[model samples]
Target: MTLQKKVIWITGASSGIGEALAYEFNKKGAHLILSARRIEELERVKENCSDSEESVKILPLDLAETHGMNDKVLEALAYFGHVDMLINNGGISQRSYAVDTQMSTVRRVMEVNFFGTVALTKALLPTFIEQKSGHVVVISSVMGKFGTKFRSTYAASKHALHGYFDSLRQEVYDHNIDVTLVCPGYIKTDVTINALTGSGEKYNKMSKGHKNAMPPDEFAKKLIPKLAARKEEIYLGGAELMGVYLKRFVPKLFNKILKRVSVT
Candidate 1:
């Protein structure tokens, strides 16, 4: 279906890629459900949409509040009566070495990035089944495809999404439910500063490479069309995207390069 008439619900919509997606989809005439923990920020995104008067609903939510996901999702269903698509984009990043990271931090990352995403997807599955049509767009990362230093838990969580969503795609293919996993590299966003370190503190610092990364708006512009067409797996970013293959055919080379990569 054309995005012009689609109803999309986006998480992590307060800023970055999610906010950009909200704007891009609005330009295409889609009804949007913009969600994030920051209500004011979500409202700002809605205001920035192509048509502010149009049907753009703001639902502030925290993915980390895993227990309340079902209720929030049900409330979302009530917003439009049916959700045409769910963009499972709310997630955290890792900024510490695996050994140095705390178990609590790892679990928290998994909860927000993997389990919480799955929970929301499961809650919405019955709705898709009843209609026999829907799309699930997951914003994964190149790190999801291949592991790197100081980001073990983040990589694992993203990798888990790939496995789960890929399987779900096949299971529901016959029912017209499509799943698209977006693997983005270093598109500029606050993901780095907000990432959790080994001690579970916010990194609060930008990586040197991130300052020169792709703009979120441009990334979203490229992504919206792909989602509309329902591509199963799409990769974004520059050399980062190439890392996927570097890990496959040249493991040693990949390890050598990653060893110099720093999250600090």
Candidate 2:
């Protein structure tokens, strides 16, 4: 879909990839609804956009607030008459070993990353159906494609996005509702630092790997166009993008490599 004048809602727009996406789309002439828990951060991003007041709206939301999602989405949707694309990008990350992780941590991760995304998508489905044309872009992870150390819960949450969206794609293919699942490797983001440890607490420290990853703006620039074309699935990263192939064609080698890689 052409982004020009399109109305897009991007969750997790307070920073990182989502924030970069908001700017990129703004530059491409898309009207945006930026959301996250930090209203000030959202405002900062909005200010940076050209025609900030006219082109963008900020709606602060906590995706993990399960009970208020319906109301939150209603309020967010009030900004645009119709949402052309809903970017399900708001989510938390896990930072503990799976075996050591508490059930609460797993549930919280699933709640924010999986259920929250699915709920928001469901809430907007009727609007898309009415329009008969819409796009759902999910920002998953390269880890979604494979299991990694200290990230079993996180991997599971992202992997669930693939399963849910892939199924929804087939179900809605006839309705002109396009779904794009983005599996990105590390991009410069606070996702890792904010990732949850075993006891359901934030790690609050950036991982060395994340600090050295690709810049979010560059990653967003590379990704947004593919999304515009309604690609089914796209992977963005460096050598880690190759893991998709390795996991499928060389499980033994992939396992070996994964063993050597550091997740935290």
Per TM-score, the best of the predicted structures is 2
* lDDT, candidate 1, 1-264, per-residue tens: 577757899999998899888888898888899889989998888888766655799888888777887788788888778789999988889898788999999999999999989988888888899899999999999988898778899999999999999999989988899999999989899999999999899999888768899999999999987887789999888777778998899999888987887645
User: Over 4 Å off in model 2, which ranges?
Assistant: none
For each candidate in the order shown, give its overall lDDT on alpha carbons. 0.88, 0.89
TM-score of each: 0.96, 0.96
- Candidate with maximal lDDT: 2
Candidate 2 lDDT, tens digit per residue, 142-222? 888898888999999998999999999999988899999999987889998898999988899998877889999999899
Output the worst ten-in-a-row residue range by lDDT, candidate 2.
Answer: 64-73
Check candidate 2 and list the clashing pairs.
none
